[model samples]
Target: MFFEILKNLRKKFKRLYITMFKNYIIFVFLMLLVLSGTIGFMIFSIGKMVSSEDYIKDTQKFFMASKIVKSDYKKIDASKIVASKGWVEILNSNKKVIYVIGTKKDKVTSYTENELLNFMDLSYNNLKSGTSYFYSVTAFNSNGEDLYCIVKVPPGIVTLNVDIAPSPDKYIKKAAIYILVGIFIIIVFLTVSVFLYAYLTTKKVVMPLKKILQGIKRMTEEDYSTRINFNAENKFGEIRDAFNFMAEKIEASIFERNRMENLKQQLLSDISHDLKTPLTSIMGYSKALNDGVVENDKKIKQYLNIIYNKSKRTVSLIENLHEFTKLDNSKFLISKEECDFCEFVREIVSEYYNEFEEKNFELEINLPEDEIIYEFDKVEMERAISNIISNILKYNEVGTKAKIELTYDNSKIQLIIADDGVGIDESLKENIFEPFVRGDKSRYTKGGTGLGLSIANKIVQKHGGTLTLEKCKKYKTVFRLKL
Candidate 1:
């Protein structure tokens, strides 16, 4: 048990209950060791005091002195008696001391019958003389006469006071039973103490565990907000922190999942509405032409052109939806290469320069002379930039000032496209880059699929860059692309 308890102490475990239990075991073991040592010491002391060799040898010496005094008192040596730190007195039947041997300190030479009996009694006390001695008396026959021989030993030499009885077996048996009962009571008391300590110590650990379990049960019931508070120490404190952190992460994950689900539903609804409007126009125009509803040749040509335009718009919407879906795919990879960003912007702007002139819109172009080379997919990057430029032309008035500026430093390149056009609605600014989110309320008349900004944002993200609609003091709408 000692080895097992010590071994557990040597290891470092994260569990609180195990550690507490080990400590309790160690405490009980130590208490038992101490109790056992105390009991053993008490038994050893009692046995040594009761039946020691010194006590037995002293009794034998007194018996030998009695025999020698009865047979031949002169042969009993006084030197031997004095050396043993005691004296001998030979008393006649009249209770009078007839002979004395060794160094005697007492002056009493005669004793009354009552005094003699008192001296021989087990509870003998020499209070009047202010000195105490142990007396052993032996009655024997000398020359056919009765004589009492008393051996007096000082208290410092040997002290034994035992009651004379016919049989001492019953007393011994009673003493043994009392000792056994005392030991049993002590063992029971110590056992109860150990268990109480174990329960109290383990209770501290169990309470915290119960609290954590309750939190887990609540979470399993879809209560993501459930949390636990444990104002404990060591492993329990750490467990509390870990559990709370896990709960926060789970709650956040659930919230994000719900948000993405809502966005998916909104995207589906917008797709359906945009597709149905263009298809309805195409179907109606074709039906009118096939049924000969228009008689004039000019009207027939106009109706055919309208049907053709509506079909083209429907096809464009489908193609934009396809591009958005492809870009949103997690497995999609962009082919990146080193390209001159300054020249790339200039070329894209030159393509739209004629359109700007035809629309009578003011244009501002700012491009650095030195080449700013960056890694990006040229085709994808062109599509993203063209989407922003096309949106500016589609929404702004004829006299709206359009600006394209490219700037760079040693670390990064920034391209800014700004226009003083009808600014985006405040309500839509936050979600402007979400799919199917449009600035124009009239979906049919806007001539846009509303996936332009979202696709552009995704493309820039794929190239490890950012495209953000930032606040600007000079322009109403500013799109900043950083690489």
Candidate 2:
């Protein structure tokens, strides 16, 4: 029943507060239980010790009672003797009773001298056979008379009859006071110890929790600079580390998001700039022809050619934008199959043969005589190769050496395109594959959209291949493709 109440208290106290409070309550309760048990066990042990001894220690009290009856009964109150719960009997030297006090007259009061010698022994045996009692007999020294008496003392408070004086009441009261004081001292010491332990333990917990709460508050205010600086090897330490990691990730994500937003604004400006140049030229040329500004067949033909070219540039820009958008979408799908890569590039270069001749640019092709088969999306790969070739035509000087080389081993394939024209600007090399990035800043410098390299790189990557620019051994610039 006691344990059940303690268990209920533990549950109630636990729900009352935080973990630190729970520890404090449990520690105090345990200390109190230990103190109670210690005091209870000690008091019980003292009682057992006092009871284990025989009643022979009461002999001194009985001797004092015999003295009172022998010489001082007339001076002492009979009620006081009865209050001591003992009766007195005096016998003459002949062993006959002279007087009896505080008890009825009995047969053992008178005896022969020999009988008196054995009287106490027989009386004790009889008393043992009935109920337990304590008695004493001694020669009383009073008035120079030889007298003997027996005092039968009952079991209330027996006054000690020891020589040199004894005070039973004083000792008992002092012992009881000392026991109470000792218990109080122990309780005070235990209370102090319990509170000290609770204070130290709760401080350990609250200090770390305070630091963590401060960090979280900073994080809530969008301040990710501060860190939780806990070094303990415990669960709180794990919480601190995890919190730091989350804050770091959130900071990085915000930085990246801002960067992308700036890039998006820049892309819009570039697109508008590119489209406006062609549209302006087309509008001006058409207006001239409509207004009869070209008066002859030759001027009219030249104006028509200019208008057609401007229209074509505008169409190319829109197409490139659409293609890039599609490729950037993660859901965009491409069809793949095994095809002859060398033949595929050969066909693409053949389509550009007329343009190469018109521009007076040289075309060099290198391939193994046998067909080199590879898995790829045929239409996408052809578009990528055409974009590479188109970039060479648009950027390279006329009559520059333009070479296409295909090399393969057991595991992979490499395709190289080189041109002996002005290489990419050193400043733009790092971001050459970025969307709408071109060597020449002016949209009219080269009559093409700048998305060629960017779109080509994306297509090659989608086919589990990479496209990168590298230093050429025999050419001004080279673009290498590895699959």
Candidate 3:
């Protein structure tokens, strides 16, 4: 429920903001109109209510003058005072008669004369106190210098005359003029306010968003570096942060993917190198065996043996390369089962006893009876170790004893495979484990692809270990595996 309320409030605020965006002029106009109304009431209407009191002040003034007369005057003719002025009424304390008259612009106005007389008599009653009195009225200049007439104050209510043009109904016209003036002021303020507000809002909000849109357009066109770096607080800041995060992720993903593709290409190049050399040697040997131009059984048997070995070497290279490919592609999952490392290597070497006999290759096995247990993937480790053995078997010629040593020291397992037959050339020792790089040119065309060591190197690396031809000379090549 709270979330709903917040959602509603957000929608409402957005609508208000959009309304401000779209019809700001109209809104400003309406605001100015309200302000003008307040100002108008203050200026022309509000205080005036107390000022005129609807002609009541005039009536009260008249009554006060008549009362002063009654208190001060002795017996005298009341009609003479009324006759002294022409059309004006004397508001005098020493006057003989008390009377009231109405005038405008120094001349008596005849409109509503009867109502005027009734009011005059009512004012006199508040003053006269039942004294014998006949009221008189006269019109006067604005200075009260002329006398007008003597008549019964109650009876002569309608005798006055007025000359005038139509008064223009000033009250209604004044109201209309005030209204028009108010509308004019409101229009001026509204127009200016709306124009300024529209300019500022567009400059601050709409223009920045446009810039962000332009950046997006650039990005859509494959400009990866396009950035929306707006320095803002509210909604615009949020937009910038979101875009930045997305861009960062995109760049990282692209970099990693490109790196992987390059690595795959490099792997293919290595495979070609290993396969081409072996197949070339195999072809030369197979042609020799097939031609059978040998003069003796001995040379022919040698040719056939070379062909068989070359074929085996090519097959082993391809298999090992495929295994490495699987590992590199994350298709293989290794298991962590404990095994006696010394026993494992010893037993594996023992399995190839017949091949050793046929090739007259002596195996020098050095191990301890104390079981060296280690955690590894069994089948994969076997392939890795066996590939190294295969490399030794292919490179070392007849009667060459291959040294196999396994030792554990200081909480680490180490395996050493060394061959004393034309080991590896000193200059090429460093690159011996690189894919398809055969170190000893003298040992070239012996019968094995060079990728064997590379696969072994990669597998050992995968096991959090290192395999290196640590040292090599003309007669000794030593490979050390530390796990």
Worst 10 residues of 2 by lDDT: 53-62
- Candidate 2: tens digits of C-alpha lDDT, residues 160-232: 3342144456445645865787688787888788788867655655676788779878877889675888665
Better of 2 and 3 by lDDT: 2
Instruction: Please give the lDDT score for candidate 1.
Output: 0.78
Instruction: Indicate the residue-level lDDT of 439 in model 1.
Output: 78
> Which stretches of candidate 1 lie above 4 Å from their native place?
1-210, 229-238
lDDT of 3: 0.62
Candidate 2 wrongly placed segments (more than 4 Å): 1-216, 224-248, 350-373, 399-403, 407-410, 472-476
TM-score of 3: 0.39
Q: Each prediction's Cα RMSD?
A: 13.8, 14.9, 15.6
Best TM-score goes to which candidate? 1
Ranking 1 against 2 by lDDT, winner: 1
Provide the TM-score for each candidate, comma-separated: 0.58, 0.52, 0.39
